[model samples]
Target: METAYIKTPVGIARIEGDEHGVSVISIVDEATQLSPEIPNILSKAAQELHEYFEGERRDFSFALNPRGTDFQKAVWQELRDIPFGKTTSYMELSRKLGDVKAIRAVAAANGKNPLWIVVPCHRVIGSDGSLTGYAGGLWRKKWLLEHETPPVQHRLF
Candidate 1:
């Protein structure tokens, strides 16, 4: 797998994948060195990420090859369907999967999502709208969510 590390507003992001598509992308510390030579595939991913952070893109368009079990794959796929700037709860996801009792399992899968922002696992939240666990840190999760949210309109009544 080809690996590339790029700096972002939140942290340094390590991207790993090949023609088969991106398999893993996780945030590293800001002190990490930026990749001097990015592979073709990883360069594409990095560019898309830059646009995402710049608010120029909402939905990502690229091939993904996340490795996981059948259940985990299903959960990750559902995470992709979450609209930009929208949030869903683990309970809601479990209901969508037709097994409310699998909330814990769904949460586990969401937490294990390897594609990071591309899969949008950060969109998942607690049932009470509270921010929950995030592999990249809750601060980064909040940053991602806030980045996706549209600016509120100021109306004079």
Candidate 2:
């Protein structure tokens, strides 16, 4: 798989994939070398990510090939359906999947999401609207959510 590391506002993002599609996009806190040359196959994905960070794009159009079990794949698919600036809860996701009791499983699948912002696992929150567990760290999650939020306009009157 082709790999590229790009620096972002929150941290260094590691993107991996090939012609088959992007398989992983993870954030890392450690200091690491950025890719000297972006692979030809991953250029689009890299550019799209830059647009996303710049608030010029709301949805991704590139192919995704995240590796996971059937259940995990299902959960990830649902995550993609979440609006760019909206948030959903674990319980709500479980209900959408037609299994309220499967909340834990759904949470697990969300936690295991490998595509990062592409899949939008960061959109998932606790039932109480609290920012919860994020493999990349809660701070990064908050940064992502805040970045996606539309600015509230104040009245000049």
Cα deviation in Å at residue 115, candidate 2?
0.5
* lDDT score for residue 138 of model 2: 91
Q: List the residue pairs that clash in candidate 1.
A: none
Q: Which clashing pairs does model 2 show?
A: none
CA lDDT, every prediction? 0.91, 0.93
The deviation in Å at residue 68 for candidate 2 is 0.4
Compute each candidate's TM-score over C-alphas: 0.95, 0.97
Instruction: Tell me the spans in candidate 2 whose CA falls farther than 4 Å from its real position.
Output: none
lDDT of 1 by residue, 1-157 (tens): 9999988898889999989998999998657788899899888899999999998988887788889999999999899999999999999999999999999999999989998899999999998899999989899999999899967989979
- Runs in model 1 with CA error above 4 Å? 155-157
In model 1, the worst 10-residue window by lDDT is 26-35
